[model samples]
Target: MSSKVSLLISIILHAGVAFAQGPAFERTPLFILEKNRNPENIMVIYTQLDSECRVQKKRGGSEKVVFDFYWLMKRKDFKQVNPIIKKEIRSRLELLPSNDTHSFSVMMNDLKELDTDIKDFKLIVTANKKKGNCVTESILKLGESDQNKKVKLESIYAESKGFLIPTVISVTVNGIDAETGAKVTRKYMKK
Candidate 1:
């Protein structure tokens, strides 16, 4: 076989392997309050709804929202993943009958206490309900240099996506707002 043929065969095999590994996971961004501040030490905010408490407008019913927040760090080998700052909120959904969706901002508090000097890590937020589980994950890259950046929070929506079926629960991690800061409380009403 010629040298060119062998090279082409090797390239094809590598491409196949890459495709088999699967596409990258989508990440939501966490807004950092101050520039040049350490991402781990600073306050980061994202929006999420109560997993149990969602208003299914199309279908009239009750929804249960359970919020679970975890911090996933890729180990040195890159294959191993570990969880940190694992918190489970037992709060129930304050339901509203007439609303189509429920949205709110969630603040990630007490990150400095983790005690691990990780330059970067992934934030995974999971909402579990009677219908199904919904998850929103984001990667936070904290480098050694002071980049002096501020992260802004934006609204995100989750849908049941079924015609006859109602959404069990939907949580939107609205991005952090530097001006308003983390919301202390939110109210949901019923139809």
Candidate 2:
């Protein structure tokens, strides 16, 4: 039909336009988790992958995302956390700019994956079991009717043994192929 042909042409044109505009690197905050007791400490995750060329210009960089972890602490003070530990492990990765303990930026790349080298990494919750209102990664599509709905983070389990540990978060990302329109997803876990 003529309508179908017009739609196909439109898609081709849009694809061409997108191609003409160089790679648009962007970061989209997809999920997060907060410490059980300390509200000031939270792990924010971004699902967008910054390309190799974009990251390694100055030096070597981390490429792929690997594992989700939590830095367990008994006290609210993060000054005790080591700065070198963030990127010391050859095959590990964690948030960087060591000065900021409150909100850490994920420092990673694509070719090589990253893992958070936390000694006592644990899960705060999941879809079924939850210690408190926590976070994990899930690829989801927003339905037309659900677009405006807001999901609330509720804390049901309030009891902690005086230890303020962050909620367990997982590593996962989703994308769509520019050429094929097929959906793509990647997740990394420890052996």
Candidate 3:
């Protein structure tokens, strides 16, 4: 084949591959759960989780979660906090030394309400132990509801270090939030 024709063929093939892969998403809503055994006092679980987005209104759908957590010990120095979502620290629950297993549930909804599209967001859980800190993270994603009759939901686990118990982070394409300045606000659970 002529060099010109070969070049044209190569370009066509590359274009086809690129188109088949679909648009690049900045933050994907998939997560893989990671089990950390270093700090053994904390456990986190997600219940009643859901996410949706309304493109026409430029408003994101309600992203809600039932955050069930358990702290295995109670001490004067023991600290358990969700710093990202909860800004203020209140009455100490661990003022007195006790062996009681402390557990509580956090219900946070309306996490990703933005003028632009949000692919997904992450919920982080961290537990403070005398030995070290252990972290658990979960991610939520929203898809086209009307277009796809059945909205697919699945769970994947990932490992990362950062943040303390019951924290949330909203993720969007850089372009989307640049102009709108819209962000997700976290609701703290009543103590």
Candidate 4:
């Protein structure tokens, strides 16, 4: 066979292999909200649990990877937070088109329309206060009506230092507040 024929065959076989694999997402998270382990003090999502997802839909046949860039921060590193958040957002927005990843971003805060991307898609968060031993529970769903609601994937936490232990972070969402800016706010007991 000619060299050209052999090269074409090689390319076809490589393409087939690539197509077989799918997009990759890590169980590792850039950051996490953890419950205080003290038995006396239970964990309650003080103000509200904001759950927002920034989705980058798959394109073509490329199996993209979840974007998980790790970094460290000191308390003083961020003097004014809004500016920082905005700058970070702007940077990421520019890079989104260049990324070969199928990633989602979780954002929060009282910026009013800070997180309405999923408003039409919608997610319901229930912040049930802890009672006796029942413990506080939270649920996340997509869509407004129960018929349209879809359960999210079971989330696993990622830890380092001690180990890359997978941890699950749960937050209760009372509702999605378009006006208040605080979506899924919970009442926590302090005593």
Indicate which candidate wins on TM-score: 2
lDDT of each: 0.26, 0.29, 0.23, 0.26
Q: Which residue pairs collide, candidate 4?
A: 48-185, 125-173, 157-167
The TM-scores of all predictions, comma-separated, are 0.20, 0.24, 0.19, 0.21
lDDT of 4 by residue, 1-191 (tens): 56643443343223211111112221122221223232222111111111222222334763332322221122111122245533543342222222412233233321222222234322122222123111111123334433333333222121112223322233322333333333333321211
lDDT of 1 at 26: 16
Root-mean-square deviation per candidate:
18.9, 18.4, 21.1, 21.5
Error of model 4, residue 79, in angstroms: 17
RMSD of 3: 21.1
Q: Once superposed on the true structure, which residue ranges of model 3 sit more than 4 Å away at CA?
A: 1-43, 46-67, 70-108, 115-152, 155-191
TM-score for candidate 1, residues paired by index: 0.20
Q: What's the lDDT of the predicted structure labeled candidate 2?
A: 0.29
Better of 2 and 3 by lDDT: 2
Q: List the residue pairs that clash in candidate 3.
A: 31-156, 32-156, 32-157, 32-158, 33-157, 33-158, 126-165
What TM-score does candidate 2 get on C-alpha atoms?
0.24
Off by over 4 Å in 1: 1-66, 74-85, 88-102, 105-151, 154-191
Pick out the ten consecutive residues of candidate 4 with the lowest summed lDDT.
41-50
Query: Where is model 1 poorest over a 10-residue stretch in terms of lDDT?
Result: 17-26
What stretches of model 2 exceed 4 Å from their correct place?
Answer: 1-23, 50-63, 66-137, 140-191
